[model samples]
Target: MLSQLQKKLLNDFQQDFPLSPAPYADIAKTLGVSEQEVLSALQELKQLDFISRIGPVFPPNSLGNSMLVAMSVPEEQLQTVAEIINQFQEVNHNYHRENRFNLWFVLIGNNQNHLHAVISEIESETGFPAMRLPMIANYFINLGFELDWND
Candidate 1:
């Protein structure tokens, strides 16, 4: 169950995240809570997987390139493969799926070449071929949710 504070924190400030000297503190004041309270709630939300991350959402084509890459991994080797994939700073998101390309991740870079290099490195380092699925078109959506989870 989501706490009132957690729900508020997730829905109220999805976008226009604080870009000030003390962003979390700013949110604390706005939410009538202490800085530590806001920080704690945010941390809890992340730990609970209610949110992937609380960070900047860069404009597509502005921060180089990104792709939805996936690779097949034997069940016994999934953890090891995931660990190697997570080592790259370019990897913003990684997850396990129930498909042949079971280990999935999103890779971001400053350019197409840089993006490919990261992919190449992952393949070389992990010895698993990654299928790159770059976006041909994107329809922007409000990723934020307005939940009615009774607290």
Candidate 2:
């Protein structure tokens, strides 16, 4: 279970992680806590596996091109296909969505051609066609959800 302070800190931190050389210091000032405390809280959260990462969410065009791809992987070959897709440097996230296209992943590349090449390679290696869904535009919405620590 998280202490009240820790919970408050987490709730606030999600909205904005400081963009300073010393982000902890900035967060500390805002939360009325010491910089060490901020760092310690984040470390503790990581230890508990409540937070997977504490980093920036880069804008798509700022870095490279990316697409959401789904593939219909056989149950027996799911692991193999996942491993093959994960080997690509452009693939950032992969998961098993609940649908016909069970294996889903994100492919990010230096350019559109690079993204296409990576997808083609995965298809050739896995013998599964990847359905690509590229985001044309994004509408910002807060994706925050409350965690039930008590449960």
Query: Cα deviation in Å at residue 43, candidate 2?
Result: 2.2
lDDT of 2 by residue, 41-116 (tens): 8889889987878876677756988899999988888998899889988899999888888998998878888888
- Which 10-residue window of candidate 1 scores lowest in summed lDDT? 142-151
Residue-level lDDT tens digits of model 1 in 37-70: 9988889989989888888877776757888898
Question: What TM-score does each of the candidates earn?
Answer: 0.66, 0.82
Task: RMSD for all candidates, in order, please.
Answer: 4.2, 2.4
**Candidate 2 lDDT score at position 39:** 82
Off by over 4 Å in 1: 1-9, 15-56
What's the lDDT for all of these models?
0.88, 0.84
lDDT of 2: 0.84
**Residue 141 lDDT in candidate 1:** 76
